[model samples]
Target chain A: MPDAPDAVEQAVRQVLTSINGDLTPTETMLLGELEALAQEIQRAKREISALSIGDISDSHIPVATDELDAVLAHTAEATNEILDCCEKLENTAPELPEGPAAVVNDAVTRIYEACSFQDITGQRIGKVVTALKAIEARLMRVTDRFGSVSSAPAEPQAPDTRTQGQQLANGPQLPGNASSQAEIDSLLASFD
Target chain B: MDKNTNILIVDDYKTMLRIIRNLLKQLDFNNVDEASDGSEALTKLRAGNFGLVISDWNMVPMTGLDLLKEVRADARLKNLPFIMITAESKTENVVAAKQAGVSNYIVKPFNAETLKEKIEKVMVHA
Candidate 1:
């Protein structure tokens, strides 16, 4: 039933009485403890967040995948050109000397056999591409769930320069990027 | 088997199709056609008179295995000779292709001789 001003005064008196009017006792201690608990909860939240997969922004994975794709495609194209030239030479090589002609034809056949790298590498690259696609999908889901780690909005991707087949072609890689042909041959032989 | 038998080569990768076609040409088999994937391959198969089907095992939209199943299921095309080319040399994949009625299997990175041998084996029997 008290007026507003009287009500405020009574509330202040009750709070002072709780602290024994010294103003730096029970109430102050309780307020400080509440603040500390709040800070502790905040720290716990941070720890839990750190336990997540962690931020992967600015990662080179995309660039690496793209570069691998480009390199493989280029290798296949170049090899195809070489095979074409070999085929042409085999066709055009004169029949004057049957021995030389046969030798040249055999050499061309060997080169044609070597060009099989395209098909083999293409399959290998297809497997890698499938894996990369799955990873990219999972990464997108993760970003959607946890939000982006970077504050900067992602830069818009430039238009891809690769043509249709070029994008899909994953040709043979050098020994540095993939296992050597000997390793592959051994693995295949094991299957037999 | 006639060297002039109409052949259909299917692969999503253009380079692969080209390589296969070139290999076929080298073998003096000039009647060759191409499709980009299993779906397109099926369309071509249904529309054309192809004697043999050469397909890559992995492709988007539909795989060669799926195409083989479809081909076998279609009564009109059930007896078509199908050759599967794959990079996977796993026993399971080979068995699966066999179970699906694949006429022949060629592992990737194969030479023209390998291709010729498989085609001859399949065509002679087909």
Candidate 2:
């Protein structure tokens, strides 16, 4: 009793329904891949945070010559670990997806590379810190020696008998007399 | 030098000044004076008999460099040794200080070791 045209339309509709149903397996496969990638990205981020490179570099550790080499070596080792992780991720990354998923994958890759670069940078900074510590230690020793040499008390003598040069070298003589003033002025001029 | 030998330390940071004072005390140089800025330091220098000056480069009212210039220009204090403590690590700053007749230079945040070396070097060379 159905019209011929209606019957033909129903057949076409059935075919379209079957074709859509066939895509279920493909969609499930893509979704599973996406879920795995998301989990991988999250795990990578957690690992990066656990490495704590920023905290280590920012810390105010007392630096010494002996420790400097060790610190740098440790930094390099840590960086290497991060790089290895990134290499693993790069190698295992699934075939590129289209649309927003591709964008996310690209972002994740860039982050991994950035983390690797930071590690390298941190090692270089560690070396510099070590060198600076050595310089600081040397300077402190010199300051200590000067302090001892300068602080030793000389034999006591009458103030008036002391030479003007001696008084200025000792310190500014109190009671700003013309003689002391003249002596200090003359000494200051020599620097010019 | 005895307990009477007056030394002046100038810096903007109170903590730094205290550290220097404590270090000076350890070396048996008990007669140490402190000023918080270049102007204050200059005032103290003029008011008291100071043997040596240790100053920070970056300070308000006057810089360590300016204070050095003033000390050098003054007839009475011309021979006074001036050491500059700075955070700047540039070669140019060091060269400039040497040219200005600075007795020595030390970069910060320095430990006690670097401080000692520079002081000895300046005392001997200057």
Candidate 3:
């Protein structure tokens, strides 16, 4: 066991260096190429692993988009339905105590009118959906590039048509940045 | 405000179009037409005799700002009252809309009252 380790290193050195009659120049060169090929293989493996789709963070984009879309769609639909029912109720004009009937009619119409929120919200949600779609397409390209042998479709480049100062069209800022209706009106006043 | 004045509502979303139409109806402005995007709005603006325009800001290919500019650039529609409805409350967006000759701007989630005020103001000024 004392000579075991030393003997193996000595023999390998002899094979590669050809200090002994055990190897030819061609065979030694071939061994060098094989060693290089092994290093190439390791590099290739690292690159493949780097692109593993499983490593991609669970993108909340799709989940958020789906939930937002569903909520917007449902809200819009329900609002429209209520509006229709209100219109019908207004039209029927059933015999009732005139005061209560007028109150109910006005309330119903207000509710019907309030339903317009759904349309604007639905529009905003649509913009979110479009942005999510662009993100999803990129993620799919990333997945396909490393996950599949076939060539993935090329990612479409969006044209740069943003306003000179505004690069991204950010819709409705979060609580902090979003100005209240009062602030907006004040700003308008100041402009005037 | 003339409730009988012909108005054009432009937005990419059908929902927004419907909502604007309904809101206009509530304001007693029933003579309203719809366009789904700035391009369509421009085309309709050319074809029809609309006195006012209410448009959304985030449409594709052409945005409400673009429509505003186009409307301003057009000889026939230059003075037509235009209001922009946007979720973008950024000062820059407001400034840009103002520069583009927008009659007024409405931040999103606005109610019928706000819509009426903006429309009436624009109509009066125009």
Per-model C-alpha RMSD: 11.1, 31.6, 8.9
On the 0 to 100 scale, the lDDT of residue A53 in model 2 is: 41
lDDT of 2 by residue, A77-176 (tens): 6655654564454444555455655564455444443443332333345456655656555545444443352556645855685322112221111232
User: What lDDT tens digits, residue by residue, belong to model 1 across residues A1-192?
Assistant: 763344544566577667575556666676556556656655655564574433332355566578778978798879879877986877776653888887887787777767767767766676686777677667666555445334566569799974332343333344355443244434444544
Give the per-residue lDDT of model 1 (tens digit) for B1-126. Answer: 799999999988777787788778778899999998889999999999999999987776777888888899988899999998766455455566677788877766677877888789889888
- Docking quality (DockQ) of candidate 3: 0.47
Write down the DockQ of candidate 1.
0.29
lDDT agreement with native, every candidate: 0.72, 0.58, 0.75
How do the residues B39-81 of candidate 3 rate in per-residue lDDT, one tens digit apiece? 9999999999999999888777788888888899999999999
For residue A177, give model 1's deviation from the true position in Å. Answer: 19
Q: In model 3, which runs have C-alpha deviations exceeding 4 angstroms?
A: A1-72, A90-109, A112-159, A163-168
Deviating ranges (above 4 Å) for candidate 2? A1-192, B1-4, B124-126
lDDT of 2 at A80: 54
lDDT of 2: 0.58
Q: After superposition, how far is residue A126 of candidate 1 from its true place, in Å?
A: 3.7
* lDDT of model 3 at position A129: 84
Model 2 chain B scores worst on lDDT over the 10 consecutive residues at B87-96
Docking class of 3: acceptable
